[model samples]
Target: MPTISMFYGILVSMYALDIDKHHLPHIHVRYNEFKTVIAIPDGEVLEGRLPIRQSKLIQAWVELHRDELMADWFLAASGQTPFKIDPLR
Candidate 1:
């Protein structure tokens, strides 16, 4: 997994050649002990959990960077390194 961004205590990442399990364009997020997978197109939680405030922040970040995220998804699906995205600030 390659970390694409980090902010506040949250770390966002994606795995190269990953697609089948989740079956969607998504990113993995980790905040302390909480970890989750968030789908890109709709910002839905595909797995795990996060604190409510952190979850909302991640959703907002996804909405703000959907296009960039999708592009990164494509690169990752093809087993290429994804470009770093701007962290939420």
Candidate 2:
């Protein structure tokens, strides 16, 4: 798994796997016992479950670091150096 970003110990990561014969541009968010994927760029939750508060936090993080997340996802998919998003935003 590649880590795209981190916020308050919550990690946004991605893994390369063929889903239905096509590679999807999505990333996973892991916090506590929560694990889920939110589609890149749009920040749409696709899998697993996150509580409302946690979900909001994830959304804000994704929005503030959209560029880094996308770049990291690409890098991870291409086997390049996985990028870490700045938590400065």
Candidate 3:
């Protein structure tokens, strides 16, 4: 997995394997021992679980970075830019 961004202590990453399967723009949130996949464009939860507090923080972060997130997703999928997302709001 390649980290796309970091926000509120959560590392946002995306995996090539994930793209091969899901084929959708998305990012993963990692905090402590928790990890959750967040679908881009719509900010939907795709997999795993996150604590309530962490989830709220990620939700806010995702909403604020929706545009950048999508851009990162495209760049990652297309192998244009290294998988690195912009900072959180």
- Which model scores highest in lDDT? 1
lDDT of candidate 3 over 1-89, digit per residue (tens): 77777877888777653577666787778899998888877778888989998888778877887887776676677766544656656
Rate residue 35 of model 2 by lDDT.
88
The TM-score of predicted model 2 comes to 0.78
lDDT of 1: 0.96
Model 2 agreement with the true structure over 37-68: per-residue lDDT tens digits: 78877888778878788788888877887787
The list of candidate 2 runs beyond 4 A from truth reads: 16-22
lDDT of 1 by residue, 1-89 (tens): 89999999999999999998999999999999999999999998999999999999999999999999999999999999999999999
Q: List the residue pairs that clash in candidate 2.
A: none
- Worst 10-residue lDDT window for candidate 3 reads 80-89
lDDT (CA) per prediction: 0.96, 0.72, 0.76
**Model 3 stretches with alpha carbons more than 4 Å out:** none
Worst 10 residues of 1 by lDDT: 17-26
In candidate 1, position 57 carries an lDDT of 94
- Candidate 2 C-alpha error for residue 33, in Å: 1.3
